[model samples]
Target chain A: DAGVTQSPTHLIKTRGQHVTLRCSPISGHKSVSWYQQVLGQGPQFIFQYYEKEERGRGNFPDRFSARQFPNYSSELNVNALLLGDSALYLCASSSLFRDRVTGNEQFFGPGTRLTVL
Target chain B: ELKVEQNPLFLSMQEGKNYTIYCNYSTTSDRLYWYRQDPGKSLESLFVLLSNGAVKQEGRLMASLDTKARLSTLHITAAVHDLSATYFCAVDTPLVFGKGTRLSVIA
Candidate 1:
C-alpha cells in the first residue's frame, strides 16, 4: 500500500502570488490534515478534513484554506502569499476510526516546499 | 489553547550514549504523539501514546506519556548515528506540536 503522497516537490512564488499544494491520502484513509513547517520548527496544523467536511482548523489566517475530495485527496491553497508563508507544507492522512481509538498517528507525505521570493 | 513545549531544543551526544527529551503541554489531552524528521524531509510517526501511562518502544527509541502531569518523554538508549534527526511531540487536539528536539548522535 502506498503511503500518503504530495505533489510539486518544490515551488517558488512571488509575495502576492497564490499557490496550491495537493495531497493524496493512503488507501482506505478518510481523514486528511494540512500543516506548515517552518525551518527549525515543528509543523503547525492548518486544516483537517474528515469525511469531506472540515473537522478542525489551526491558528492560520484566512489566507490559508483547504478542501478534501471524495477520494480523500486534499488541496491546500494559500492566497496572497507573504514572505512569512515560505515553508514546507505537509499533508497527513489517517483512518478516522483508528485515529479516535488510538492517538492520531498520522501518516505524512514528503511535503511540498514553498518559497515566496 | 493547547501549548506543547519540548526541552533540550538541540541535543548532541556520542554513539552508545543515552539521553532523554521531554515534552510538556498545557491543558488536558488523552492523545500524544512523537515524530521524527530528517533534514528537508517530512515527519515519520514514531509513537502514539493514548493513555495516562502509555509507553511504546521501537529500536533504540522509547516514548512514554503521563497525562496527569501533561508530560511525555522520549528516551534514546545507546544512541547511534542513524538516529540523528529532529524529534517532536504533539498533542492531538487541534494537533499542537512542540518546537522539536534536534538530536545529533555522533559516532
Candidate 2:
C-alpha cells in the first residue's frame, strides 16, 4: 500500500503572495493533518481535518486555512505569506480519529518545501 | 501549550556504540511516538508508546515511555551507519514534537 502523498515538492513564492499545498492520504485513511517545520526545528501542527470537517487547529494565524476533500485528500492554503513562512509543509495521515491504544501513529509525506522570498 | 524538548540535539558516535536519546514533554499525554527522518525526507514512524513503562523495540532501536514523568527515551544499541538520521518524539495532545536529535553514526 502506498503512503501519504504530497504535491508541488518545492515552491518559491514572494512575500504577501498566496500558496496552496496539496496532500493525498493513504488509501482508506480518514484523518489528515498539516504541519510547518522551520529550519533546524521540529514540525508545528497547523491544522487537522477528519471526514471533511475541521477537527483541530494549531497556533497558526488566520492567513492559514485547510480543507479535506471527500477522497481524504487535503489542501493547505496560506495567504499574505511572510518571510518566516519559508519552511517545509508536511502532511500526515492516520487511520483512526481518536486512537484509544496508540493515538494513531501518523505517516507523513515527503513534504512540500516552500520558500518565501 | 504543550512543548516537547529533546536532549543532545546532535549526536555523533562511532558504529557499534550504544546511545540513548531523551524526550520530555511539558504536559500530560498517554500516547507518545518516535519517528525517524533522513535528510530532505519525511518522518517515518518508529514506535508508539501508549502507557507508562511501555516499551517497544525494532532492529537496533528501542523506545520506552513514562507517562507519569512525561518522558520518553529512544535507545540505539550497536548503532550502524545506516541508522544515522534525525529522530523525533511526538505527543498526542496538540501533536507537539521535540526539537529532534540528529544522530550521525560513523563507520
Per-residue lDDT for B1-107 in model 2, tens only? 78899998999999999999999999888999898999989999999889899999999999999999999999999999999999999998457899999999998
Model 2 Cα RMSD, 1 decimal: 1.0
**For all the predictions, what are the DockQ values?**
0.75, 0.81
| Docking level for model 1 | medium
Worst 10 residues of 1 chain A by lDDT: A96-105
Cα shift from native, residue A17, model 1 (Å): 0.8
Worst 10 residues of 2 chain A by lDDT: A96-105
Residues forming the 10-long window of minimal summed lDDT in candidate 1 chain B:
B88-97
The Cα local distance difference test for each model comes to 0.91, 0.93
Query: What residue pairs are clashing in model 1?
Result: none
Give the alpha carbon lDDT tens digit for every residue of A2-116 in model 1: 9999999999999999999999999999999999999989999899999999998888899999999989899999999999999999999988834567565688999999999
Q: Which residue pairs does candidate 2 place in steric collision? A: none
lDDT of 1 at B88: 92
